[model samples]
Target: MEKYLMKSKAMHYVFVIIGTILMAVSINLVYEPLGMVTGGITGLAIVIKELTGFIIKGGIPLWVTNIILNIPLIICAVYILGKKLLLHTLFATLCLSAALALVPSVNILPEDYLLAAVFGGALGGVGLGMIFVASASTGGTDLLAMLIHRFKPYYSIPRILIVIDGFVVAVGAMVFGISKTLYAIIAVYITTKVSDGILEGLKFAKMAYVISDSYDEIAKAIMEKLERGVTGVYAKGMYSDKDKKMLFCVVSKKEIVDLTELVSEIDPKAFIIVSDVREVMGEGFIEYKQ
Candidate 1:
């Protein structure tokens, strides 16, 4: 058990590092050059960078703004909540700051807003996905969300984050203009979709509910041929007023065709409902892990 925990911790940090690099690259190389602000502390930093460019040469660096902004937030959070709760967040945030500082800025993509938004969002999404999978966050507005939720327990963290990030985006619109802001919104949308895909797409499966008089035979064939398990659910047919066994099974997308065919072959009148499953765990799927 101890060894497993140690390995898990190591893997978590590894994921954080890789995710930080992707996120920083997206910000510095793609979003910064195009003046796209998607939201979060980095977005605010971009706005500040542009504003300060009037006075300071090249304005403030992203890492500088990130560190300065996060420090006070981190200190307040620690003071109000506790250190233990923010340890992982601190680590991830520091890694991101380091990455932003070290990763050289370059125009890797064309100056096209659409292209920048798509690729930037893709990189940020994958980075966020991995960071979330590691059970950590890059702090910034995430920490702000936590603090707000702590004070106002009635409001959820995610809702608070939306409000806060939206405010940031609105402010960014003021700085970057409506056209760039529109592209930023598109980038944000793509980021959300890709991140959600990373989190749930890989584990997606198909679920089927089979109802027929020959449920037993269908279950047997599914288990024997498909090498999958089926559950007999006690169901009552409302129209017929008969107690029947409904077969419940889950299989990969590739195997759903075979499962339906096998059911149709055995019982022509079988009422089968197939649905998409976002995630499945257990035998023949992802193993349960601590």
Candidate 2:
């Protein structure tokens, strides 16, 4: 238990570090320089700062506002995702906020708005992806999405997030004018794309389901040549009502082409379906059981 706890803590720190670096790069190099508002607490803060110019006395500074907004989200995470997720998320959020406040003192990128938007969005996405991999979040609207998901599991979290973010962007347009608001939308889109890319890269796995006449040979080849365990599932063809031996195995993307070629050589008419799995956990995968 002690060993596991230490390992978990170490993993959390690694995620926090990656999140911090990405957030810092996005804020300093892209979003702030370009005056592009994103779809989170940070975006809201940017608009507020641009409109008020730091003159809102007694109200929270953008930095403080960020911390405050995440509080409820963290609480929600504790309930939805569990205590371990909450702690890692808190660590990531604090570190991100601190990086934003501190890193600006040293300008690190060009002032071109387009460049800023593209790179900043990419950086922010990667950061968010790292946080997600750790089963944590940087809070904000994500917490709200999770809370909603907890009570209504059928509701799409992504759609909920988009609606909330859209509202926020509308507010930004009203406050920061149409031009800045449009740029913010662009940044948000870029951020989402980059985040997706990062997540995809980090958790790339292939799920292959094969049905062929040469089931035994194919299974043997996969197990021995590929050094991967295969599950021989008893399956029935829906249309034909014929019994079949279905071979299921998860492997890396690098092996997909080779696996396909090998299957083709053995059985030219084999039916193979390949799906991209975001994450896998267990022996010969992510080691979740341990």
- For candidate 2, give the lDDT of residue 35: 60
Assess every candidate by TM-score.
Answer: 0.89, 0.76
Q: Can you list the residue pairs that collide in candidate 2?
A: none
Error of 2 at 32 (Å): 2.2
Q: Residue by residue across 1-290, what tens digits does model 2's lDDT show?
A: 11222366577678767777777767656665556666778777766666676577523445667897788778866866789777767877888788777775233555565666676767777777666556566678766765776688776444456667888888877876678667667767776666555544455689999999799999999988998889999999989999999999998889988789889999999999999987776677666434
What is every candidate's alpha-carbon RMSD to the true fold?
Answer: 3.2, 4.4
On TM-score, the leading prediction is: 1
Residue 87 lDDT, candidate 2, scale 0-100? 72
- lDDT per residue as tens, model 1, 35-103: 888888999999999999989999999988988888878887888778775787889899999999999
Runs of candidate 1 with Cα error greater than 4 angstroms are 1-6, 79-81, 145-163
